[model samples]
Target chain A: MTTPPLAETILSFLKKINPHQPLPTAEQNLFELALLSSSDFITLIQLLEEESGILLDFTQIDPAALASMQGLLAAFSAAETGSKL
Target chain B: MDHYPWLSPPDHTAQALRMDHHLWHYGQLMTHAELLSRAIDWSIAGPLRLLAILGNQDPWVYPAMLAAHRLGGGFLPLHPAFPSERLQHMLHQCQTRLLLVTSDGLATLDQLLPNLSDSMLCIITEDTKGNRPLLFPQHRFLDSTDLQQLPARPAHPAPNTQAAYVMFTSGSTGRAKGVAVSFANLHAYVRYWQTHHPIGPGDRVAQPADITFDLSIHPIFVSWASGALLCPIPPATRFAPARFILEQQLTVWVSVPSVAMMMERLNILRPALFPTIRLSLFCGEPLPTRTAEAWRQSTPQGRLLNLYGPTEATVAISAFEWQAESAQQEPPGNVPIGWTFPEQQAALLQEDGSLLLSAGTGDLCLAGSQVTGGYLADPDKSAAHYFYHPDSGATLWYRTGDWVQRREDGCLLFLNRVDQQIKRHGYRIELHEIEHVLRARVGHDWVAVIPWPGGTQPVRALVACVAAEENSPTADWLQHCRQHLPSYMVPSRIMVVPQLPLNHNGKINRAALQQLVQATLFPTEAT
Candidate 1:
């Protein structure tokens, strides 16, 4: 079985958290739309780690990286590729 | 001995405080305060209070507080993170003429220049070069360099009846209400602490609260009066509170329960992590049983205390010493608020204005030395909450708005706020009770219960926002709640979030949670 893309996994998790609200596009601002809080950001990181098999240190990651869907995908991609964020 | 205990001579050498790398001795604090007081007298012509917008744990803040008191003027401490509009409102509310700002607060003041009055005076503590232009040309600017050159004067005493400080609390009316605490009230609180929980020389008290919060008053005044060292935790280290306590070897730990919740979230609360802390206190919000247990394990040698009070009450007017065995005997969510202070009287009043002596739930009313005079310059607001007690020789009682049940043992167990009580299906439900049940089941201390479809609806759903560890399923939490709570009391929806939102005061922001529930669960409804 093939794995889903990073953006797909993030969008899926966002939908699970708030099924009533419209799902955000990859470039949409999750934080600005009130779809994410500090706690929700932590949960998103955990979900991304599970889906991508990349362990990210919550303390080391900048909170700005979780502000938007694009930022979330970038953070996940950086962790997966072992590159600096 | 000076009438003001804070200005009196220390019992030992002046090593009174340590803020990170900086060490402030008693003599240095008094000398700087004297110099700052003289500068204020020279620069400002009229009677005015000095409002400080500095870091809570800044070394200059304590002296600024003393200087203001010495000049017979009140000191208002404001959080720098507050929006310029709110800051402007506070400045206007207090009629602040002189503002004491640290070099860090200069940028914030610059942004607020448009909102500040032209007659305002700015005193910058770290501006030695004196290069920064005044935010307003009419605004007078003084720097630390100028204050050091001013000749020191003898300590001028403020009247005991004078207002010591003015703190702004968010009012239910969407505006900030200024609470003016008098010197007599503070003195009474200090005397109460001295008589009950006495701190002596060599004690290191932790200052973890924001300078604007009333919780900060406990460590600041108690440490200064006892000649003990006030160790202020830096903002960067606040998240890792257990590590900060261990590194500082803080003898007395005083902070909101949120710090412990954060420590628990980060898995930092190891057994015996804070062995040096002799007195551990949690206040500003409800103390969950699990958080209390984790804290007790960390500070095995320390005495765990839960204090209760609003800003209207000076610091904390009541306290409960948590005992391990007794805590286990009580219900899972119940943490007794314990006994009122010696000078204060606590009563539970029913809806019909009759007092409930024992074994009943009602509004908790407090009357005594710890209560403030009233809200700043707003008698209407003050009259709404405070009233004269005809039975107690006309003593004013502050209606706390907190609904608490007086147990037969004379201890008070806090229920939800009277405002938070929702009537659904012809049944009145306390939202905090549902939150308590959820917290007990989820093993998480950070949980909030807000009314869903929130408005003037007679029947509303209860939405439970639980801060769970990663990968925890919401269905299991819902099942757990169903098992524990009755049909009417169980929450309609159990939402699993990573953390609960906090407002400026560090308490659970119910308004923000209600907004989140509305946006996510009821998006079609008007917020």
Candidate 2:
């Protein structure tokens, strides 16, 4: 259930948008839980790009996995590593 | 059932719907509607009873709508994601007789059950997942199995003048009001799309909008009227819909322009990526030139259209096609709303409270069959917006608040709003409505809601400014807003200021306040 810090950044950013929401579990699928919508997922990607200083390739990401915080965090770490390599 | 192709499908074998791995033909869809309609007719005795479909976006939605009309009742779509309080007001406002639930809507129905009035909430669903008993002597569940056992009963087609559906839009009075669109009104609008456009049996249309949104009306009617396939894209796939669109080989695409903005953000809008798309219909918000151009490239064989209208006018009344380029006449950047449909009449309401028939810029007004009869049961609101124009020989005209400019060539350009109403993320919102709810909670009149980076551009946030308040009740205000207003209407930020900017006439200076809010959002750009 544990994800990288980038997931923490997304959770914090989501909190800013919907202030009333409680933090979701690391294994929880934000989309199914209705905590975050698909539109919000795209917005989170833009915010993550701004914070990470990398242009992530969304074509390489698995949409189903990206629905969870841990999966999103893992994708971010992979994108960061890919950019450096 | 007369003009609708779904009644007796054009080709019973032709595919009519694609949802959740099931591809149902026109006959199959009609059977579902027939069976469901008989079940409804048996349980609820009476014609013209309103049926409210409460659920997430799903395939069963269209069938439920058909079932309602099949029994001569009206269909009302309610998004379960909205706060329970707002949904209660809508249900009570229309005196909903039956509640139709989809598989995805179970949790939402559970939350809404306790708060409902003492009267029975007649529910129709497929899967109950039963464990706890429902309220006795009041509530009842009618599942698919029950519907299958019911004997066949003929559907009573309502009169054309009767309402086909009633759509609820944001109300500045703090509760939403319903715009009752009759069968005649719906047919008048849908007939235009069917006759004028080339869409036919082979086309597969992607309805990317939620049922609650009026934009979704286009695909459901336009496709079914011509025997085309209707694909109600799931909510999870909407923002990132490239794969689904490509996989379905969708031929027609309909959605808000902001969705393309989302696709643009995700870098999914590449040229020629959606070659199968033959028609691109954009409405519910202004279409940016950049988004339109990218979409035009994506659909190499398609036509890109920009349309404009309020929910009161039955979807859209005007459209501009991208391929018909008179480069000299078109304005820069923002796409024009083009011309009103030939079947309707358009006039301008000038600044001095007079009608302008031919030229000049002013608030837009529409008249004809497409104009709604009136808001449900509220003659006062009906009087405020809908009226007969004395100069036009008593023709009923619906006042559209959009500021528009018309040229000698009959092309229309969207200027701006004539009021504080704004479109945030393709959702029509009245800023005054947000302020109205907050004023009651905060117990003050100083709070003003402003769309950040304002003036027709995409709104990033709704910022509330309170004068002379030392502490910002940001968290509490958000909690209160979540319970009262829809998410899009909720203010993302609350700023405590010394005093709100004011004009010399003692009015809140909106332009000055917009500058202040924008400055706060982007501090480095502030002077």
Candidate 3:
């Protein structure tokens, strides 16, 4: 999946499970805080893999990889190419 | 004298709740005090035997507790998931004169009333819709109004040292022991925990485990002591509990590692769910390293603490916070229990009785006010477990049969239990505990119990019984067990064997039986 698509998928999965949170966006801001949480990030990754067929290893994804929507997109690209984007 | 209600006076009401619409507003919970006061009034005159049907994550537990106190009657909280027989055994064992069932929970008692009618009094907590209350012809149903009309005249306090609650602990002897934790021990425990950990008004706590499991004390007493809102969560949703945590904004989270693993599987770690989870406490079993790592990774800002203790030690003896940096420094799966709680005094004692305070692994010895006086109605077992220290004549310590090693950092890491006790999926299981219940119900002389957890998440039991019995063990055992043990402790499969394998010493070799289970070749292998 493309970077924007991966971010959108994760954002949507988080939205589905916990509707209490204001809707997350593909843009980088407070949405980055969701990736910092292990439970939310794992949920995002699992949904991303199931929906978009992109494999994200929790250990491999660094802070910068989840810093912004563009950065998350790039990380997906790196994961697709089997290297750090 | 210390107050009978040992809780510190409540202050900072804003700290009373974190998440909104979770259970009740502070004002609503206060209204329960009057309701609870009325319920307590009814119980003061006679022995009120109450069986608390605990499963629904209702915040109404506090009021039920207040009512239980007012009646001068002790509570027998049973897991709703417990099979009919186990529930019956609990009701009979407690000599439960009164039962408190929720309106939605009336159907569970239908099958086991015959066995329970002698001592059981069925009391419904809420009203059912269309179903008229059927009289078992012998059982009495107490309604919500009956709860409200509880007499106001006060009675003497129930014996604090007597068995207030008796839940089964798993053992190797194939029988579950009813670990009777007294009100004094529970009271002392919460008091000690409060002095050290200190909870207050605004703290919202989650009751995640089934109440039958002793670990549920975290939500129960912690909330009561601090006047914090106690939000009970269903056991089914324990795995994906982050949803509730997020929805409710709970500040305190209590659960077992297996439940934590389930949470990881369900993916509830988004920031929205865990923003307020400051105190993430794990007990009932060791926090698996992978699970701990997941928690550390997920809630980087949250404080992860691990508590270790048996029901015999009240609720917990020692605790350690999972320092993210420290855990990251160590290899995977090497998480250590960090330290003892401030109020608790613990020491590792060798089999020879010499204190292993400096180094080495031994049975964890617990000493403090929180140590229960003794087991109920089982003096022999209690004498064998509670020992007086030789050096100090007055200092008594309870031998916690659990094996653990003291780390260089002063934290203790739990090894295997010395006896045949196993902590499966956060339940302290004694194989013999199940066997005892089985024998009591089935009248069987020869029975060998072993856990078979090769595939299923819950550690199901494989029972080997005398093959010559006219009635072979089957699903009926499940019904029989439901009367005595909690639902999780029941054996899933029973295999009747002509004879059990005995070693050269002529004792039943559990390892051999476990091997048979592991190979999936007990009486027969699956297709």
Which runs of model 2 end up more than 4 angstroms from their true locations? A1-25, A28-43, A50-65, A77-85, B1-10, B41-48, B127-136, B324-329, B468-471, B524-527
Cα lDDT tens digits, model 1, B374-450, are 88767888998888765667778898888888888888888767776554432335576667667777786798888
Segments in model 3 whose C-alpha atoms lie over 4 Å from true places: A1-85, B1-22, B36-59, B70-73, B109-114, B117-123, B127-141, B146-166, B171-176, B180-184, B265-273, B328-334, B353-355, B435-449, B452-485, B492-527
Q: Which CAPRI category fits model 3?
A: incorrect
Q: What DockQ results for candidate 2? A: 0.32
Lowest summed lDDT across 10 adjacent residues in model 3 chain B is found at B39-48
lDDT rank, highest first? 2, 1, 3
Tell me the interface RMSD of every candidate, in Å.
Answer: 8.3, 3.6, 14.8
lDDT of 2 by residue, B1-527 (tens): 32233343567899998887888998778777776675574244223477788875567777888887876767878887788988878777777657788876777777777787645444556655263244433566677776777787677777888778878878777778888888888888988887788588889999877888888888888888788999988765676677778878999999888778778877888889888999999988888777788788878889998988888888999999987353344555678888988788889987777889886898899998888877876888888888887788878889878899898888898889888888876789988888888887777888899876676666656788877466556667766877788777887677778888889999999898888887765464322
Ranking by TM-score: 2, 1, 3
The RMSD of every model to the true structure, in order and in angstroms, is 11.3, 3.5, 10.7
Q: What is the TM-score of chain A alone in each candidate?
A: 0.76, 0.79, 0.58
* Segments of candidate 1 deviating more than 4 angstroms: A1-85, B1-4, B7-14, B42-51, B54-57, B129-135, B420-527
Sorted by DockQ (best first), the order is: 2, 1, 3
Among these predictions, the greatest lDDT belongs to 2
> Against the true structure, what is each candidate's TM-score?
0.73, 0.90, 0.71
